[model samples]
Target: MCVEKTPWEQVIDFHGHTCPEIALGYRVAQIAMRELGIKPTPSAELKVTAQTHSCALDAFQVLNHATYGRGALIVEEQGQHNYMFEYTGTTVRVFITINPEILDHLVIPKDLSSRREVQNATLEAIQFLLSSEESMFCSIQKE
Candidate 1:
Protein backbone atom coordinates (compact mmCIF):
# COMPACT_ATOMS: atom_id res chain seq x y z
CA MET A 1 0.00 0.00 0.00
CA CYS A 2 1.27 3.46 -0.87
CA VAL A 3 0.57 6.44 1.34
CA GLU A 4 0.33 9.91 -0.22
CA LYS A 5 1.80 12.98 1.37
CA THR A 6 -0.54 15.91 1.63
CA PRO A 7 0.38 19.06 -0.25
CA TRP A 8 1.56 22.05 1.73
CA GLU A 9 -0.44 25.28 1.70
CA GLN A 10 1.47 28.52 1.23
CA VAL A 11 0.22 31.82 2.63
CA ILE A 12 1.53 35.41 2.68
CA ASP A 13 0.19 38.38 4.62
CA PHE A 14 0.92 42.01 3.74
CA HIS A 15 -0.08 44.88 5.99
CA GLY A 16 0.44 48.41 4.72
CA HIS A 17 -1.35 51.72 4.30
CA THR A 18 -0.89 51.57 0.58
CA CYS A 19 -3.21 48.99 -0.86
CA PRO A 20 -1.22 48.88 -4.05
CA GLU A 21 1.97 48.03 -2.22
CA ILE A 22 0.28 45.21 -0.35
CA ALA A 23 -1.21 43.89 -3.56
CA LEU A 24 2.19 44.06 -5.23
CA GLY A 25 3.70 42.09 -2.39
CA TYR A 26 1.09 39.42 -2.84
CA ARG A 27 1.85 39.19 -6.53
CA VAL A 28 5.57 38.92 -5.88
CA ALA A 29 5.12 36.06 -3.43
CA GLN A 30 2.86 34.25 -5.84
CA ILE A 31 5.47 34.54 -8.53
CA ALA A 32 8.26 33.41 -6.27
CA MET A 33 6.35 30.31 -5.25
CA ARG A 34 5.68 29.49 -8.88
CA GLU A 35 9.37 29.79 -9.64
CA LEU A 36 10.09 27.47 -6.75
CA GLY A 37 7.64 24.86 -8.03
CA ILE A 38 5.50 24.66 -4.90
CA LYS A 39 1.75 24.18 -5.02
CA PRO A 40 -0.44 26.12 -2.65
CA THR A 41 -3.23 24.25 -0.91
CA PRO A 42 -6.48 24.94 -2.78
CA SER A 43 -8.45 26.41 0.12
CA ALA A 44 -6.09 26.34 3.07
CA GLU A 45 -6.17 29.63 4.93
CA LEU A 46 -2.80 30.53 6.41
CA LYS A 47 -2.39 33.34 8.93
CA VAL A 48 0.75 35.25 7.92
CA THR A 49 2.00 37.09 10.97
CA ALA A 50 4.15 40.12 10.13
CA GLN A 51 6.39 41.44 7.43
CA THR A 52 9.99 41.35 8.69
CA HIS A 53 13.07 43.31 7.57
CA SER A 54 14.32 40.21 5.85
CA CYS A 55 11.24 40.15 3.64
CA ALA A 56 11.63 43.83 2.79
CA LEU A 57 15.33 43.38 2.13
CA ASP A 58 14.63 40.46 -0.12
CA ALA A 59 12.21 42.54 -2.14
CA PHE A 60 14.58 45.47 -2.30
CA GLN A 61 17.42 43.30 -3.57
CA VAL A 62 15.30 41.69 -6.23
CA LEU A 63 13.66 44.94 -7.25
CA ASN A 64 16.72 47.18 -6.93
CA HIS A 65 17.51 47.25 -10.64
CA ALA A 66 13.96 48.17 -11.43
CA THR A 67 13.54 50.84 -8.74
CA TYR A 68 16.88 52.53 -9.52
CA GLY A 69 17.86 55.09 -6.85
CA ARG A 70 14.37 55.18 -5.41
CA GLY A 71 14.79 51.61 -4.25
CA ALA A 72 18.02 52.38 -2.38
CA LEU A 73 16.39 54.47 0.33
CA ILE A 74 13.72 53.09 2.57
CA VAL A 75 11.22 55.84 1.76
CA GLU A 76 8.63 54.01 3.82
CA GLU A 77 9.37 51.93 6.88
CA GLN A 78 6.29 49.75 6.24
CA GLY A 79 6.49 48.76 9.87
CA GLN A 80 7.88 45.65 11.54
CA HIS A 81 5.54 42.70 11.50
CA ASN A 82 5.37 39.04 10.57
CA TYR A 83 3.54 37.29 7.74
CA MET A 84 1.37 34.54 9.21
CA PHE A 85 0.51 31.40 7.30
CA GLU A 86 -1.85 28.54 8.14
CA TYR A 87 -2.75 25.45 6.16
CA THR A 88 -5.87 23.37 6.54
CA GLY A 89 -6.90 20.76 4.02
CA THR A 90 -6.60 22.16 0.48
CA THR A 91 -7.11 25.84 1.09
CA VAL A 92 -4.59 28.53 2.03
CA ARG A 93 -5.27 32.00 3.45
CA VAL A 94 -2.85 34.87 4.12
CA PHE A 95 -3.06 37.77 6.54
CA ILE A 96 -0.82 40.84 6.79
CA THR A 97 -1.03 43.18 9.75
CA ILE A 98 0.57 46.57 9.28
CA ASN A 99 2.44 48.40 12.01
CA PRO A 100 1.10 51.92 12.58
CA GLU A 101 4.63 53.31 12.50
CA ILE A 102 4.79 52.45 8.84
CA LEU A 103 2.38 55.22 7.97
CA ASP A 104 4.56 57.78 9.71
CA HIS A 105 7.50 56.88 7.49
CA LEU A 106 5.85 57.65 4.15
CA VAL A 107 7.90 60.39 2.56
CA ILE A 108 6.23 62.55 0.02
CA PRO A 109 8.77 63.91 -2.41
CA LYS A 110 8.55 67.54 -3.49
CA ASP A 111 8.62 66.69 -7.17
CA LEU A 112 6.30 64.35 -9.00
CA SER A 113 8.95 63.59 -11.63
CA SER A 114 11.08 61.64 -9.19
CA ARG A 115 8.03 59.84 -7.87
CA ARG A 116 7.02 58.83 -11.37
CA GLU A 117 10.48 57.49 -12.05
CA VAL A 118 10.32 55.28 -8.99
CA GLN A 119 6.83 54.14 -9.81
CA ASN A 120 7.86 53.20 -13.33
CA ALA A 121 10.81 51.25 -12.07
CA THR A 122 8.69 49.37 -9.57
CA LEU A 123 6.15 48.62 -12.27
CA GLU A 124 8.86 47.23 -14.50
CA ALA A 125 10.03 44.87 -11.80
CA ILE A 126 6.49 43.64 -11.16
CA GLN A 127 5.88 43.13 -14.84
CA PHE A 128 9.13 41.25 -15.30
CA LEU A 129 8.35 38.91 -12.45
CA LEU A 130 4.76 38.30 -13.54
CA SER A 131 5.74 37.64 -17.15
CA SER A 132 8.56 35.30 -16.35
CA GLU A 133 7.97 31.62 -17.10
CA GLU A 134 8.80 30.82 -13.49
CA SER A 135 5.59 32.50 -12.20
CA MET A 136 3.25 30.13 -13.94
CA PHE A 137 3.01 27.60 -11.17
CA CYS A 138 2.38 29.94 -8.23
CA SER A 139 -1.03 30.96 -6.88
CA ILE A 140 -1.58 34.06 -4.73
CA GLN A 141 -4.71 34.80 -2.74
CA LYS A 142 -5.18 37.93 -0.68
CA GLU A 143 -7.03 38.08 2.63
Candidate 2:
Protein backbone atom coordinates (compact mmCIF):
# COMPACT_ATOMS: atom_id res chain seq x y z
CA MET A 1 0.00 0.00 0.00
CA CYS A 2 1.12 3.60 -0.71
CA VAL A 3 1.09 6.27 1.96
CA GLU A 4 0.55 10.03 1.67
CA LYS A 5 2.83 12.61 3.23
CA THR A 6 1.47 15.67 5.03
CA PRO A 7 2.05 19.18 3.76
CA TRP A 8 3.91 20.17 6.92
CA GLU A 9 6.26 17.29 6.37
CA GLN A 10 6.92 18.42 2.86
CA VAL A 11 7.54 21.99 3.95
CA ILE A 12 9.85 20.91 6.72
CA ASP A 13 11.72 18.68 4.38
CA PHE A 14 12.20 21.53 1.95
CA HIS A 15 13.36 23.88 4.70
CA GLY A 16 15.71 21.25 6.02
CA HIS A 17 18.17 22.16 3.29
CA THR A 18 20.94 24.67 4.04
CA CYS A 19 22.57 25.68 0.77
CA PRO A 20 19.91 28.13 -0.41
CA GLU A 21 19.70 30.02 2.87
CA ILE A 22 23.45 30.47 3.15
CA ALA A 23 23.80 31.75 -0.39
CA LEU A 24 20.94 34.20 0.00
CA GLY A 25 22.25 35.46 3.31
CA TYR A 26 25.65 36.15 1.82
CA ARG A 27 24.13 38.02 -1.10
CA VAL A 28 21.95 40.15 1.12
CA ALA A 29 24.91 41.01 3.29
CA GLN A 30 26.93 42.00 0.26
CA ILE A 31 24.25 44.28 -1.17
CA ALA A 32 23.62 45.94 2.16
CA MET A 33 27.29 46.67 2.74
CA ARG A 34 27.75 48.03 -0.76
CA GLU A 35 24.78 50.36 -0.42
CA LEU A 36 26.18 51.65 2.84
CA GLY A 37 29.43 52.66 1.09
CA ILE A 38 31.41 50.06 2.99
CA LYS A 39 33.23 47.41 0.98
CA PRO A 40 32.17 43.83 1.71
CA THR A 41 34.65 41.49 3.30
CA PRO A 42 35.62 38.62 1.02
CA SER A 43 34.71 36.05 3.69
CA ALA A 44 31.29 35.54 5.26
CA GLU A 45 29.14 32.89 6.93
CA LEU A 46 26.06 31.49 5.29
CA LYS A 47 24.20 28.61 6.86
CA VAL A 48 20.73 27.21 7.26
CA THR A 49 19.54 26.21 10.69
CA ALA A 50 16.33 26.11 12.69
CA GLN A 51 16.82 29.52 14.29
CA THR A 52 18.21 31.22 11.19
CA HIS A 53 16.17 29.44 8.59
CA SER A 54 12.94 31.43 8.69
CA CYS A 55 14.06 34.96 7.92
CA ALA A 56 17.78 34.71 7.24
CA LEU A 57 17.43 36.37 3.86
CA ASP A 58 14.93 38.94 5.05
CA ALA A 59 17.08 39.86 8.02
CA PHE A 60 20.13 40.34 5.84
CA GLN A 61 18.24 42.42 3.30
CA VAL A 62 16.51 44.56 5.87
CA LEU A 63 19.67 45.20 7.82
CA ASN A 64 21.51 46.07 4.64
CA HIS A 65 18.83 48.49 3.42
CA ALA A 66 18.31 50.05 6.81
CA THR A 67 22.00 50.65 7.09
CA TYR A 68 22.35 51.97 3.58
CA GLY A 69 24.04 55.36 3.33
CA ARG A 70 26.00 54.44 6.40
CA GLY A 71 29.06 52.32 7.15
CA ALA A 72 29.90 49.54 9.60
CA LEU A 73 31.02 45.95 9.62
CA ILE A 74 27.98 43.85 10.34
CA VAL A 75 29.39 40.96 12.29
CA GLU A 76 26.74 38.36 12.93
CA GLU A 77 28.01 36.03 15.56
CA GLN A 78 25.85 33.35 17.00
CA GLY A 79 27.68 31.67 19.81
CA GLN A 80 31.00 30.49 18.39
CA HIS A 81 29.80 30.92 14.80
CA ASN A 82 30.67 34.26 13.22
CA TYR A 83 29.96 36.14 10.02
CA MET A 84 31.92 39.28 9.25
CA PHE A 85 30.91 41.82 6.65
CA GLU A 86 33.65 44.26 5.72
CA TYR A 87 33.50 47.40 3.66
CA THR A 88 36.98 47.65 2.16
CA GLY A 89 38.65 44.24 2.01
CA THR A 90 38.18 40.60 1.29
CA THR A 91 37.02 38.39 4.13
CA VAL A 92 39.63 36.22 5.75
CA ARG A 93 37.31 33.33 6.59
CA VAL A 94 33.84 32.00 6.06
CA PHE A 95 32.14 29.63 8.52
CA ILE A 96 28.68 28.24 8.00
CA THR A 97 26.61 26.48 10.62
CA ILE A 98 23.17 25.26 11.68
CA ASN A 99 23.28 25.93 15.32
CA PRO A 100 20.96 28.05 17.44
CA GLU A 101 21.97 30.28 20.38
CA ILE A 102 24.30 32.04 17.98
CA LEU A 103 24.46 35.80 18.37
CA ASP A 104 25.14 38.63 15.93
CA HIS A 105 27.34 41.61 16.62
CA LEU A 106 28.69 44.58 14.64
CA VAL A 107 32.29 45.54 14.96
CA ILE A 108 34.08 48.62 13.61
CA PRO A 109 37.74 47.88 13.36
CA LYS A 110 39.91 50.36 15.25
CA ASP A 111 41.95 51.12 12.17
CA LEU A 112 39.38 50.84 9.46
CA SER A 113 40.51 52.20 6.10
CA SER A 114 38.22 55.21 6.41
CA ARG A 115 38.09 55.63 10.14
CA ARG A 116 36.37 58.98 10.50
CA GLU A 117 33.85 58.56 7.73
CA VAL A 118 33.09 54.98 8.59
CA GLN A 119 32.63 55.80 12.25
CA ASN A 120 30.17 58.53 11.48
CA ALA A 121 28.21 56.33 9.12
CA THR A 122 28.22 53.47 11.60
CA LEU A 123 26.89 55.70 14.32
CA GLU A 124 24.13 56.93 12.08
CA ALA A 125 23.07 53.43 11.17
CA ILE A 126 23.09 52.33 14.79
CA GLN A 127 21.01 55.29 15.88
CA PHE A 128 18.49 54.85 13.11
CA LEU A 129 18.08 51.15 13.77
CA LEU A 130 17.79 51.65 17.48
CA SER A 131 15.06 54.22 17.05
CA SER A 132 13.03 52.39 14.47
CA GLU A 133 10.26 49.99 15.48
CA GLU A 134 11.49 47.49 12.95
CA SER A 135 14.91 47.35 14.59
CA MET A 136 14.00 44.83 17.24
CA PHE A 137 16.44 42.32 15.85
CA CYS A 138 19.18 44.83 15.03
CA SER A 139 19.37 46.53 18.39
CA ILE A 140 21.37 45.01 21.23
CA GLN A 141 20.30 46.75 24.38
CA LYS A 142 22.73 47.03 27.26
CA GLU A 143 21.54 45.39 30.41
Candidate 3:
Protein backbone atom coordinates (compact mmCIF):
# COMPACT_ATOMS: atom_id res chain seq x y z
CA MET A 1 0.00 0.00 0.00
CA CYS A 2 1.06 3.56 -0.60
CA VAL A 3 0.79 6.43 1.78
CA GLU A 4 0.20 10.06 1.02
CA LYS A 5 1.99 12.92 2.68
CA THR A 6 0.07 15.50 4.64
CA PRO A 7 -0.70 18.88 3.03
CA TRP A 8 2.16 20.57 4.82
CA GLU A 9 4.63 17.85 3.91
CA GLN A 10 3.56 18.29 0.31
CA VAL A 11 4.05 22.03 0.72
CA ILE A 12 7.68 21.56 1.74
CA ASP A 13 8.18 19.35 -1.27
CA PHE A 14 6.63 21.82 -3.70
CA HIS A 15 8.43 24.77 -2.15
CA GLY A 16 11.85 23.06 -2.55
CA HIS A 17 12.81 24.55 0.82
CA THR A 18 11.59 24.92 4.37
CA CYS A 19 11.73 28.03 6.56
CA PRO A 20 10.06 29.44 9.62
CA GLU A 21 7.79 31.59 7.51
CA ILE A 22 6.56 28.58 5.60
CA ALA A 23 5.64 26.83 8.82
CA LEU A 24 4.03 30.00 10.13
CA GLY A 25 2.01 30.40 6.94
CA TYR A 26 0.73 26.86 7.21
CA ARG A 27 -0.25 27.38 10.81
CA VAL A 28 -1.90 30.68 10.01
CA ALA A 29 -4.00 29.13 7.29
CA GLN A 30 -5.11 26.39 9.66
CA ILE A 31 -6.06 28.90 12.31
CA ALA A 32 -8.12 30.88 9.81
CA MET A 33 -9.91 27.80 8.56
CA ARG A 34 -10.69 26.73 12.09
CA GLU A 35 -12.13 30.14 12.84
CA LEU A 36 -14.50 29.84 9.89
CA GLY A 37 -15.40 26.26 10.72
CA ILE A 38 -14.33 25.22 7.25
CA LYS A 39 -12.53 22.11 6.12
CA PRO A 40 -9.27 22.32 4.27
CA THR A 41 -9.63 22.24 0.49
CA PRO A 42 -8.67 24.00 -2.73
CA SER A 43 -11.81 26.04 -2.67
CA ALA A 44 -12.45 29.59 -3.88
CA GLU A 45 -13.98 30.91 -0.68
CA LEU A 46 -10.90 31.61 1.45
CA LYS A 47 -8.93 34.77 0.80
CA VAL A 48 -5.30 35.37 1.78
CA THR A 49 -3.49 38.65 1.92
CA ALA A 50 0.25 38.52 2.48
CA GLN A 51 2.50 41.47 3.21
CA THR A 52 5.50 39.93 1.49
CA HIS A 53 6.25 37.81 -1.52
CA SER A 54 8.23 35.16 0.24
CA CYS A 55 8.15 31.43 0.86
CA ALA A 56 5.30 31.94 3.30
CA LEU A 57 2.98 33.04 0.51
CA ASP A 58 3.90 30.02 -1.50
CA ALA A 59 3.16 27.80 1.47
CA PHE A 60 -0.22 29.42 1.86
CA GLN A 61 -0.99 28.82 -1.79
CA VAL A 62 0.20 25.25 -1.80
CA LEU A 63 -1.29 24.14 1.49
CA ASN A 64 -4.51 26.12 1.43
CA HIS A 65 -4.99 26.67 -2.31
CA ALA A 66 -5.08 30.40 -1.83
CA THR A 67 -3.27 32.06 -4.73
CA TYR A 68 -3.36 35.13 -6.89
CA GLY A 69 -4.38 33.22 -9.95
CA ARG A 70 -7.60 32.20 -8.28
CA GLY A 71 -8.31 35.73 -7.10
CA ALA A 72 -8.20 34.54 -3.51
CA LEU A 73 -4.68 35.58 -2.55
CA ILE A 74 -3.25 39.08 -2.64
CA VAL A 75 0.34 40.16 -2.08
CA GLU A 76 1.49 43.51 -0.81
CA GLU A 77 5.21 44.28 -0.85
CA GLN A 78 5.41 45.79 2.58
CA GLY A 79 8.62 43.94 3.48
CA GLN A 80 6.83 42.43 6.45
CA HIS A 81 5.66 38.88 7.10
CA ASN A 82 2.23 39.65 8.44
CA TYR A 83 -0.59 37.59 6.90
CA MET A 84 -4.32 38.02 6.85
CA PHE A 85 -6.90 35.46 5.80
CA GLU A 86 -10.52 36.28 5.23
CA TYR A 87 -13.34 34.02 4.26
CA THR A 88 -15.65 35.27 1.59
CA GLY A 89 -19.36 35.64 2.39
CA THR A 90 -18.46 36.83 5.86
CA THR A 91 -16.70 39.64 7.67
CA VAL A 92 -14.32 37.34 9.53
CA ARG A 93 -10.62 37.87 8.99
CA VAL A 94 -7.73 36.21 10.76
CA PHE A 95 -4.48 38.10 11.05
CA ILE A 96 -1.18 36.40 11.75
CA THR A 97 1.85 38.33 12.90
CA ILE A 98 5.37 36.98 13.01
CA ASN A 99 7.59 38.16 15.83
CA PRO A 100 10.63 40.10 14.66
CA GLU A 101 12.41 39.08 17.83
CA ILE A 102 12.68 35.53 16.55
CA LEU A 103 14.37 36.66 13.35
CA ASP A 104 16.81 38.78 15.32
CA HIS A 105 18.12 35.61 16.93
CA LEU A 106 18.90 34.00 13.56
CA VAL A 107 22.34 34.42 12.04
CA ILE A 108 21.91 35.11 8.34
CA PRO A 109 24.99 34.77 6.19
CA LYS A 110 26.13 37.89 4.41
CA ASP A 111 26.12 36.28 0.98
CA LEU A 112 22.34 35.92 0.56
CA SER A 113 22.74 35.55 -3.21
CA SER A 114 24.13 32.05 -2.86
CA ARG A 115 21.19 29.67 -3.16
CA ARG A 116 22.88 26.67 -1.53
CA GLU A 117 24.21 28.63 1.44
CA VAL A 118 20.91 30.40 2.00
CA GLN A 119 18.94 27.18 1.81
CA ASN A 120 21.19 25.54 4.39
CA ALA A 121 20.86 28.46 6.77
CA THR A 122 17.11 28.63 6.23
CA LEU A 123 16.73 24.92 7.00
CA GLU A 124 18.69 25.24 10.20
CA ALA A 125 16.75 28.32 11.31
CA ILE A 126 13.47 26.63 10.52
CA GLN A 127 14.35 23.71 12.78
CA PHE A 128 15.01 26.03 15.68
CA LEU A 129 11.88 28.06 14.98
CA LEU A 130 9.73 24.95 15.00
CA SER A 131 11.12 23.71 18.30
CA SER A 132 10.77 27.07 20.01
CA GLU A 133 6.96 26.92 19.90
CA GLU A 134 4.51 29.06 17.89
CA SER A 135 3.58 31.49 20.65
CA MET A 136 7.17 32.67 20.81
CA PHE A 137 7.35 33.65 17.16
CA CYS A 138 3.81 34.37 16.02
CA SER A 139 0.37 35.47 17.11
CA ILE A 140 -2.98 34.81 15.42
CA GLN A 141 -6.26 36.55 15.97
CA LYS A 142 -9.66 36.60 14.33
CA GLU A 143 -11.36 39.86 13.55
TM-scores for all predictions: 0.29, 0.21, 0.77
Q: What is the lDDT of residue 2 in candidate 1?
A: 71
lDDT of 2 by residue, 1-143 (tens): 87776532333343453233333344334433443443244353222122232324344434433231233323334433323333334433323332232122233345657767666755654443333342332322111
Q: State the TM-score for model 2.
A: 0.21
- The worst-scoring run of ten residues by lDDT in candidate 3 lies at 35-44
Report the Cα lDDT for candidate 2.
0.36
Please give the range of 10 consecutive residues that has the lowest summed lDDT in model 2: 134-143
lDDT of candidate 1 over 46-136, digit per residue (tens): 2223345433333322322112244332333345433433333534444334334432222333354776776765555445433434324
Error of 1 at 99 (Å): 25
Candidate number achieving the greatest lDDT relative to the actual structure: 3
- Residues 1-143 of candidate 3 have per-residue lDDT tens digits of 98999887988897786676676566666666676676444443778888887766777788667877888889888988788887676677788887888765355677688888888787777677666676886787878
